[model samples]
Target: MRRTHPANMFVCECITQSLFRLMKRKPYNKITVTDLVQEAGVSRNSFYRNYQSTEEIIRQFLEEKTSKWWSEFIAYPDRYPHVISEMFYHFLDMKEEIDLLYRAGLSHLLMEHIVLCGRQSLTGELKGQLQRHQLMKQNVTEDDSYEICY
Candidate 1:
């Protein structure tokens, strides 16, 4: 999702939540824009303004959550072990969404997002910690690190 206005942000969240609710009642592949907008109590235009597809909703939610977690992860002076522990707790905060994805057979979306986030987060600060502690092998790929971390 783009940087939305405060009001449209509300709509985006509403739509996202509604999608999850609908997924609980039906398969993800069975949901549609009409179903989402109706469930969210928003118009089609509102949904279109924020998301192009249902999968985009899940991806965007994961993106926002990942960004928030990364910001907090880097803001503190905690060691890599503590930060890694916190990362699990941080994502546990989204247990509902994660469970819903699994129940809806959309785990691939979560995996894709995690892989992307893992690649992006292996930057200067965290990478240095991994190297210094010998926590990560030099040849470890992004996917390997993601698997290790999770």
Candidate 2:
């Protein structure tokens, strides 16, 4: 949405880049809105205009990354030799942020996000493998779906 307004986008982008840099250097709780605005070269109101809180920013960042992974995977569904392996590597690249989330006690949610992305972005070959391995239940349900993805 911010991208629609070039000036607002600059504000949003500056805030995002600054926050990520700060996050790498400090715990999320330790960072403040003032710190964000200062580091982002924007006013406190500018930060609030874009995000309700730092956690919201982090969530948005993760959501954007997951969306990106899905986009890339869908664009080349048959490109990967092993779908799950590709998923593993994709998450592997986020190790630092994942570790930070783990330390902040949000790993479980992130794990579920990753798994959901994995299940949704499954390639046709992977689906066939799941069917061949009988991962799917006769009456498919969320638990059965988890089994297939897991």
Candidate 3:
């Protein structure tokens, strides 16, 4: 998610909460500003004040969620070896949200985020491994390490 002012947290949360409710009731293409503001118990001006458009809200939400998954993965560095499988489990846990993103035609965004984070995690892991293994370090240059990881 983009950097939002602390004061606007309430506004964004309200908008997001309302969006989730509405999404459960209808398709993304069918939702509107009126439905948003009404469900959130806020005014149209409030909705417009925080988000440029409905799609922006969903994108920001997904970005935040994607960041969260990466943080969870990174927090346990030892899990890097099992990152792909663990991420698959995490995706299964978030099946509802993933389904919603897919239905909204934003599955590409999720895929891009996962790939970006996964690559970073693997890079970090490989560097750590090479640093800890003196014999491996003597044999493997950084480029070779990357190639091996890839």
Using lDDT, give the best candidate's number: 1
Tell me the tens digit of each residue's lDDT in model 1 across 65-113.
8886776655543444555576668789999989999988889998888
TM-score of the candidate numbered 3? 0.66
Where model 3 places Cα greater than 4 Å from the true spot, the runs are: 1-7, 119-150
- Tens digits of per-residue lDDT for model 2 on 20-81? 78877888779888999999889988887778887767666677677777666555545554
* Residues forming the 10-long window of minimal summed lDDT in candidate 3: 141-150
The RMSD of every model to the true structure, in order and in angstroms, is 3.0, 4.3, 5.1
Q: Per-prediction count of colliding residue pairs?
A: 0, 0, 0
Cα displacement (Å) at residue 58, model 2: 1.2
Model 3, position 5: C-alpha lDDT score: 72
Q: After superposing candidate 1, which stretches have Cα over 4 Å from the reference?
A: 77-84, 124-150
- lDDT for position 148 in model 1: 34
How does each model score on lDDT? 0.77, 0.69, 0.67
> How many pairs of residues in model 3 come into backbone collision?
0
lDDT of 3 by residue, 1-150 (tens): 234777577778888889878888899889989999999888887787778988778767766766777765445545444545666776687688778878878788677666555455446554465335321233444345232231
